[model samples]
Target: MIEQSRLVTPVLGFAGFSGSGKTTLLEAVIPHLKSSGLRVGLMKHSHHDIEPDKPTKDSYRLRYAGSDQLLLATSKRHMLFFEYRDNEERDPQLRECLAQLDHSRLDIVLVEGFRNETLPKIEIHRPSYVKPTLFPHDPHIIAVAYDQKPDALDEFNLPSLDLNQPSDIAGFIKHWLANAPESEKYLAYELKL
Candidate 1:
C-alpha cells in the first residue's frame, strides 16, 4: 500500500497566560464538538520533558541500546517512538509536526500552545489580571473569550464570548471553521490563495 500524505487540517488555538481556563475550556468543548460529528486532533505543549516509556521497560531499553526509532504494536494500538540523539534537538517546527497528522481525517486541530505562532487564535482573558491582553498585540488573535468583560473590551471591537460557557465557545468554533475567510491560510499546509 502507498503511504498516505498528511491531511491539510484546519488549525486553531486557545491562547492565555497560565491559570487561565484554556485547558479546562478545551476539555469541555471537545465533547460538544464531537457530538456534532467533528473529528478533532489536539496538540498540547509541555514546558518540561515527557517520558512515556520507563527506564525499566523493554522499549526504553531498546531505544537506549541503539534504536533510532521504534514502534510498539498490538492489535489494539501502536506507538512510534523516535529518539533525538542530540540534546540540542528540541522544539521542532510546529508546521512540520502538524503535517504529520492525517488532516483529511480531522475537521480541526485544537492546539494548546505555541501561542506565538501566526495561526488564528482565540484569546482567553480574565479581567482580574492586570497583564496586557493578547488581542491588542496579536493580529492572529481573531477573538477574545473572557470570564467578565474587561475595561478595554470596547477598544478592539473583535468578537467576544463568555469563557465560562463552553457551549457558546463550541458554537463559535464550529461557525468560525465553516465561515472563516481564506481559512486555508491557517491549514497544515499553506494554500495558494
Candidate 2:
C-alpha cells in the first residue's frame, strides 16, 4: 500500500522568557484545542540535552551500542531518537523539526521555545517579571497573552489574551487556524527555499 501523504497544517508558536509560563499555558490549552476536534503536533526547542530513554533500558543500550537512530514503539505511542556528532549538535532548525511530524494526523502544529524564529507566535508576558516584552521588536508576534496587561500594551495594535484562561486562548487559536494564510498553513517541505 502507498503511504498517505502528510497534510498541510498551520504552525503556531508560543514565545516567552524562561519563567513566563509558556509550557503551563500550552499544557492547559492543548486539551481545550483537542476538545474542539483539532489534532495538534508540538515541536519544542531546548538548550539542555535530553535523554528520554533510561540508561537501564535496552533501547538506551542499543543507542549507545552505535545505533544512529532508534525508534521505541509500543501500542500507545512511539518515540524516535537520533544521535548527533558533537559538531552536528546544535539548535535544530524550525523547518527541519517541522518536517519530522506526521502531519496527516494533525490539524495544526503548536511550537514552544523557538522564540527567535520567524513564525506567527503569541508572546507570553508576565508584568510582574519585569522582563522585556518581545512584541515591541518581533513583527512575528501576532498577540500577547499576559497575566496583567503590560504598561506598553496600548502602544501596539496586537490583540491581548488573558493568560489565566485557556479556553479563551484556545478560541483565539481556533480562529487563527481558520484565518491563517494558505502559505502559512502548509508544512515545511514547502518552507524550504
Candidate 3:
C-alpha cells in the first residue's frame, strides 16, 4: 500500500486487538516524538458513531439542522465536523483519512486502526490477552512491542520491543523514519522550489 499513489508522508501503524495498549504506547511516545522535533499526525478509526460536539452546543444543533460540514475555529484550535449523508454509513477508507491530514505540516502519520490494511505496523501485544499474534499472518507487521514476550516469539524472527519503555520505542520509530524507503515516503504536497 505504500506504493499506492495516495501515499503522502511516512506512515506507521500501531495495531492490535482492543485492550492491547496501542493507545497507551502512543500517548507515551508522542511526547518523545514531538520533543525530537518531529511533527506527527494521527488517524484513528472508531467502530461507533462519534458525536464530538454536544447536542447542547450550537455547532451540533446547526449540523443537525442540515449543514453538511461545519468548522469551529477558536484561537487555540480548530475542529471540523462532517455530517455524513444517510447513504454513507460505512467505515472510512484508510486513504480517505490520510487525505484529511495536512501532510506538509507533519513529518509522519501514525495510524491507530485499520489493522487489515496493507501497511507497515508495529504490533502491540499482551500475552495475557491470549489473542493470537498478528505478525505471523500480516507480512506488513515490521516489529512487535509487548509487555511480555509471547511464547510464539521463538518461531518468529522479528525485532522485539519493550512496551514499558516509550523512549526506546520512540528511538526505534525515529530510526525507522530515517531509513524508510522512498516509496513509503511519498508526500502529498511538495515544495516546487
What TM-score, computed on C-alpha atoms, does each candidate reach? Answer: 0.85, 0.91, 0.89
Query: Candidate 3, which segments miss by more than 4 Å at Cα?
Result: 1-7, 185-193
Q: Is candidate 1 or candidate 2 better by TM-score?
A: 2
**Per-candidate clashes, comma-separated:** 2, 0, 0
Considering every candidate listed, which one attains the maximal TM-score? 2
Ranking by TM-score: 2, 3, 1
Best by lDDT: 2
lDDT by residue (tens digit), candidate 1, 45-145: 76777789899999989999989889988899777776788878488567766765666678889988788888889898887876578887888888899
Q: Supply the global lDDT for candidate 3.
A: 0.85
Model 1, clash count? 2
Tell me the lDDT of candidate 2: 0.86
- lDDT of candidate 3 over 1-193, digit per residue (tens): 2333555588889999998999989999999999999999988888987888789999889999999888898999888777778876678877767766677799999999899987789999999999989998998888899999987776788889999999999999999999878665543433221
Show where candidate 1 strays beyond 4 Å: 1-7, 188-193
- The Cα error of candidate 1 at residue 25, in Å, is 1.1
By lDDT: ranked, best first: 2, 3, 1
